[model samples]
Target: MNARFTRFALVAGTVAVTTLGPSVQAQALPACASNAICLWRFQDGTGELYTWRGGYVDLPSRFTDHVGSFRANRTGAFVDWASGKECHSVRKGDYASNYSGRFGSKIDAVGDNC
Candidate 1:
């Protein structure tokens, strides 16, 4: 009986650890203000952050080719590449945890529209 109980407890502990592991490492999107565009250097809204709420504006030197994630909160906007070409459009409340795969690291500007 003692050996049986020990085995059951060990199996249950293993199951609980495995089930809770993923939740402990889950990532969440960072907070972005309304009517604004937020940029992050790393995926999942982590790392350096830059927020813009005005009209057409070019990204600073540091952010030109480093944007990895973004969130358009209550506003639509256009993301431009370093070659002055529109990369894509982000609608209101839209966000991307990792855009490096599709967009690459050529982001150079951002504005209300393309």
Candidate 2:
């Protein structure tokens, strides 16, 4: 009976450790779609996500001035069209991890030229 109890306790401990271990493990951020650019409301790819395919396009109302971080999966650029802010380049494979001040919540459009 003692040996059986010990084996059960070991198995229970292993299961608990395995279950809790992943909770603290770092999770992979969502990948930006191929041939597209992505923006996030917070840094490190957290919060809301917005994706834009190839083309000249204006950001939607919610994302007009709410982009805080970005991942340029393809070649493109983002600009603040509202206040005529300068264009911010987003080269292919570029990841702006934190846009807290520079380009933060000010992007209004995505296009080939600003």
Question: What are the RMSDs of all candidates, in order?
Answer: 3.1, 6.2
**Which candidate number would show the highest TM-score if scored against the true structure?**
1
Error of 2 at 15 (Å): 34
TM-score: model 2 vs. ground truth: 0.67
After superposition, the stretches of candidate 1 with alpha carbons farther than 4 Å from their true spots are 1-26, 81-84
lDDT of 2 by residue, 28-76 (tens): 4469999888888877789988888878888877777777788877888
Residue pairs whose backbone atoms clash in candidate 2 = none
lDDT of 1 by residue, 42-97 (tens): 88898889998867788887877788788888564556655657656677878888
Worst 10 residues of 1 by lDDT: 74-83
TM-score of each: 0.70, 0.67
